[model samples]
Target: MNIELVPERQYQVFNSVAGRHHHHQPIWQNIKNLLKSCFGTQSDSRLLNRDGSLIDINRLRQNINDKQQSYKKRHITWPYLLNIYSPSMTNSDKKIYQNRARIRYNRLKRTWQERVSQGDSFYVTLADTILKDVRRTDRHIKFFKKKKQILFNIMMTYSVYHPNPGYSQGMTDMLTPIVYVFIDESMSYFAFCSLMNRYMSSLFDQDQIEINRRIRLFNLILHSIDNELWNKINVNEENYLYVYRWLLLDCKREFYRFNHVLRVLELVWINSISPFVISQSITNYRSLFTIFICISILQEDRQIIFSYSNDEDLHKYFFSSSSSSRSHRSTKRILQQAQINYSNYILSQK
Candidate 1:
């Protein structure tokens, strides 16, 4: 019957044990207080009676276990609505679903065919370009041809799905690297769709509002970043045409490696952490990243660029569709430098 009270300082020991055992502090504190009140003194054993006798520790443990089990059982079942509403469709429902699915399938097929029929010349050009890249002795020649068809199908499907910005010229170039990376037709299609929806949709706008907005933004960003180079280019509505294609196709035609082109596109898409507080509206235009990237690319050739005496030279140098093989820096190097330069510029703005 020798019962001792838990000292005030000994609460730390109880807390430490509770922490290690993951026991709730309130429960453990309540148990301690009850023992103290009942016994009128501290006890070496946590479970005890008022008469200084040991209580059934097993019963207390069982009570807590039962409460937890009951709580979990009540709260962790399938959602009420799901339980009430069976997902299993009736025969009639299944028939209706199949009919709707069939209708959608027919519509999509019809739309895809219509797009293909309209863009026959573009498809032919695409096929020729695809075949030109594939060497006859290459192991994946058949796969390459298959991929070309998949790419064309993806473009047509995208055109059908998105009629507002229905298929544009550079779309095939944009989708080329996407199809190469995501080999599965459906995966490639969706990825291409996502790219278009998120970034390149503006380029295909019928009214050219998005296109003009982007061009203006690009000029704004370039001017802000480098007024000297911006002035040298002296870009106008007519002269910025090459840049339109570059931005629209994500510089796919410029870069050598398809993977490198895709890497740059994704980097632009991610819009990584920047030092400056960009406005919400400004951030909405994902193409700003490419604009900054263009600035970076231009900065690499700043010496040669500044030396250009006229707009035509500046245009040919910076915005030309020609291969960038002559460019000294690698795509990765240019991208890294772009990020660094952007971060520094933002920091300066702050």
Candidate 2:
């Protein structure tokens, strides 16, 4: 019943039943087609998402007119996951909207920037801890060379609002691709809040029980796939921490820039909206899908990963700069593979 390792092949569409398609298709197209049903077969044409919101067809289209009108818009591209939930706005309205958002962005930016000087114990404490993590996390937010302050401000603002598990170490890793995709602090912050509130909050819990449980599930599923590979890579139980890092950070630093990570995230969010998961009331689907993604990536580097007998070598092979650039696999293909992996895991259980 074990899922066998897959060799490289042409990209396939994600499917739980067939696991492959006869012809190749753009990943976005499949996701777009599923908009109406991802939430489930509602009697109304109104497609619902995680929060009972309607999906906007026009925004999903990224229509030619909208693109033409907003050539000079702040975000040149809108990620599908973010756009699906965003309100439709004309160019003029978007300009006004962004201007207002810019005002708020600046206000928060300065408010947190003052934390170092204000000497307020609370803000100062957050400021000191935030700055340390920001410095390290900023190292390879490749698209964020000059905008580290924006990253800092977003985290600071989030900390102020959420307070629980505010500004954890790996949060910056999750936020970088979001900010890059939205290219606007306000949109990024809002989207980040949504993700934290629903799908990914478990990763941020201060206590370790939920985190450990999920990692245990990851190890359990991985062992089910192949006990030998699991035992090899998971020596000393270190791969649990590695998987935790991947899950918590969205594996953000593992690629050339944020593009791969964003695509990976796009797939993750797509799963969050999946009818099978949502209709079945699978509250932990996001964490579940993300674990499959971790496995997909691990399986890709299997040959090289297997060569490394020790955790340290595997660690470098995973996170080292040279290793980062080593992935030639399409993000879409990896995601499709995850679909197969998840399906096979489910079948094996039965």
- The global C-alpha lDDT for each of the candidates, from Candidate 1 onward, is 0.57, 0.64
- The C-alpha local distance difference test score for the whole of candidate 1 amounts to 0.57
| Per-residue C-alpha lDDT of model 1 across residues 300-330, encoded as one tens digit per residue | 7788877877767765665554345334557
> Going through the candidates in order, what is the number of backbone clashes in each?
4, 0
Runs with alpha carbons beyond 4 Å of true place in candidate 1: 1-146, 235-237, 272-282, 324-327, 345-350
Q: Tens digits of per-residue lDDT for model 2 on 128-231?
A: 78878778774754668776877888888888878786767788777876776686777787778877876667678889666777677778778877677787
Off by over 4 Å in 2: 1-117, 274-283, 310-332, 346-350
- For model 2 the local lDDT of residue 157 reads 89
Clash-forming residue pairs, model 2: none
Clashes of 1: 4
Candidate 1 clash pair list: 4-42, 4-43, 5-42, 6-42
Give the top-scoring candidate (lDDT).
2
Cα deviation of 331 in candidate 1 (Å)?
1.7
